[model samples]
Target: MSLASHLDELSRKHSDIERQINAAMLHPSIDALEIANLKRRKLALKDEIEKLKSQPTSH
Candidate 1:
């Protein structure tokens, strides 16, 4: 897949993760460890997206 498409997919995933985190937070029986893991994964994805965006494109 092209870089643009890949970026789009990653962006969608990031948004999904954000929604998941929010939903998890609103739950009455929220698991701390689970939320931490989700947050870690989200941060990793964000870092990856930023790194990809910073790289120079070959066109």
Candidate 2:
């Protein structure tokens, strides 16, 4: 796949993960550990997206 395609896929996945984390956080029965893990995963995805955005596009 091309770089743009890869970035699009990553962005979609990041959005899905963000939604999941938000849902989990809103659940009253969610365990603290689970919430923490979800948050960590969200942060990692955000970092990856930022790294991809910072990369120079190939002509």
Candidate 3:
């Protein structure tokens, strides 16, 4: 996939995970570990997006 498309997919995933985290926060029964795992995954996605954005894709 092109860099732009890859970034878009990562961003979409990040947003989805963000929504999931928010929704999980609203439920009293949600496990803290699950929420933490989601947060870690979200962070990883963000890092990947940032890394992709920073590099010169054409190089």
Candidate 4:
């Protein structure tokens, strides 16, 4: 897959994770560990997105 497509997929996943985190927060009985795990995954995705953005794209 091309870099652009890969970046788009990552962005979509990051957005999905954000939605999941929000939904989890709204739950009456939130699991702390679950939220922490989601947050960690979100951070990792963010780092990857940033790294990809920083790389020079080939024509």
Which candidate achieves the best TM-score against the true structure?
Answer: 3
Better of 2 and 3 by lDDT: 3
Worst 10 residues of 3 by lDDT: 50-59
> Which stretch of 10 consecutive residues in model 1 shows the poorest summed lDDT?
28-37
Pick by lDDT: which candidate is best?
3
The lDDT for every candidate, in the order shown, is: 0.92, 0.82, 0.94, 0.93
Q: lDDT per residue, candidate 1, 1-59, as tens digits? A: 98889999988999999999999999969998999999998999899999999999886
TM-score of each: 0.93, 0.78, 0.94, 0.90
Model 4, position 53, has a per-residue lDDT of 96
Task: Give the poorly placed runs of model 4, Cα more than 4 Å off.
Answer: none
For candidate 2, give the lDDT of residue 22.
84
lDDT of 1 at 57: 82
lDDT of 2 by residue, 4-57 (tens): 788788788878877887898888898989878877877887788789889987
Prediction 1 TM-score vs. true? 0.93
| Cα-lDDT of candidate 2 | 0.82
Of 3 and 4, the candidate ranking higher by lDDT: 3
Candidate 3 residue 41 Cα shift, in angstroms, is 0.2
Candidate 3 backbone collisions, by pair = none
